[model samples]
Target: MAKLFYVLGASGAGKDSIMNMVREQLRDPLMVAHRYITRPVSSGNENHIELSEQEFDFRINRGLFAMHWQANGYRYGISNEVCDWLAQGLDVMVNGSRAYLPTAKARFGDQLQVVWIFVTPEILQQRLQCRGRESAQEIAQRLERAIAYDSVRPADAIVIDNSGSLQSSTEQFLTQMENTVQGQKIKVAMDSPC
Candidate 1:
């Protein structure tokens, strides 16, 4: 069975860059799901499908999203096409919200694998400053929240410390995915009727 690798991280933890690198190098049966966001498309690094508020509502009404959540003053969703990929035995990765993780776990059950990207406080501060998307005050607030979330992150999550080189982080991310795929194979074999 394929798994849903739901990745969670703080804003400046470099999740997008790491995921992009993984996508380029990954040769496994895995697919990355682009999120549908109500925010307009910007020159930002996040690779997401932008939608108007009305369009977002229309999709919600039509049951087009497999999972949806509101955060940071915007609505984000994963399309139902993810279900199709999983049904076809493809591992799917989604850039996921920390708050919505419980719902995802409840929905995906044993098939959900949580990947938590971690970064040091100093590195996070520098990245946020360089991005110039948030004011210093806002960046401070985000750091506080990141620290609190780090304290309570799920015990079962696979942590990838991305404070160093992107290449190293990419290697770690790929290793975890490979481990998950191998473990899934073992589980399937053990569960098969003799």
Candidate 2:
């Protein structure tokens, strides 16, 4: 059995970067689920499969997505193929949406772990600004949304402050993730009939 880790964070919280770093460092078997996004990939970061809105909806209708959500005006989804990796006993990490935790929990039960990465408003603002993806007004709106998310955070989630260096944040995240998985049984429906 493999653990499922859902990484949630604001736009500039470096969620993707932290996951990438951990993936590279871990000697144990692990998999990071690449998201299906309705946006064109850029050199910026975050590995994802691109799709049009029509194509995205088509997949959703066909039950191809295990989980999906719309945020920041984009559609994001976790592909059903992730179950295969998990079935192989590979720990899975994904850039997950906080809004979709309920669905994830319902599907995977105790196998699901939430890792919330966060940054200070000042750092978040700076990082988002550097991405140049949105206007000043849009950035402010995202910052406000982050604050709102904090107030409703899940009681069992492991939170990490990403307001520092990439190395520091990545290390902190990995430590917390290991702690969460220690001695806990995480299954991926490996024994089920397809």
Candidate 3:
């Protein structure tokens, strides 16, 4: 069966950069799911579909989203199209929310694989400062939150330390995916009847 690789991390953990690199280099059946968000496209580096608050409500009422959550004063959603992809036996990856992991895991069950991308606090602090998007106080708060989140990360999550070069992080992510695919193939082969 296909799996959903749920990628999540704190701000400045390089999730976007590493995922973008993986998207460019991956040659497998895994498809990355784009999120629909209430935030404007220009506000961040993520390539999400922007939706008005009213539009988001309409979709929610229509059951168009497979999963949805609110964070940082905005709503984010993953379309039901991801379900279609999984049904078609294509593995899917979604940039996910740390707070929404429980709901996602409940929905996807055994098919969900959590991938936590992280960096050392020192590196994360430097990255946040360099981004210049937050005030000093806000950055400090973020760093504290990141540390707290790291402490309670899911026990089964595949953790990637992304404090070094992007290339190294990308390679680690790719290796994880390759291993998962291979393991699935092995299980399928073993389950088939002679």
- Over 44-93, each residue of candidate 1 has an lDDT whose tens digit, in order, gives 68989999999999999999998999977789999998888877777899
lDDT of 2 by residue, 105-168 (tens): 7887766778899999899999999999889999999999988888867888888888888898
Ranking by TM-score: 1, 3, 2
lDDT, each prediction: 0.88, 0.83, 0.87
Model 3 misplaced stretches (Cα beyond 4 Å): 188-194
Candidate 3 clashing pairs?
Answer: none
TM-score, predicted candidate 3 vs. hidden true structure: 0.93
TM-score between model 2 and native: 0.91
Q: Which candidate is the best by lDDT?
A: 1
Question: Worst lDDT window (10 residues) for model 1?
Answer: 185-194
**Candidate 2 wrong stretches, greater than 4 Å:** 185-194
lDDT of 3 at 43: 75
**What is the lDDT for 17 in model 3?**
89
Ranking by lDDT: 1, 3, 2
Separately for all candidates shown, the number of backbone clashes (residues 3 or more apart, or on different chains) is 0, 0, 0
**Candidate 3: lDDT over CA atoms?**
0.87
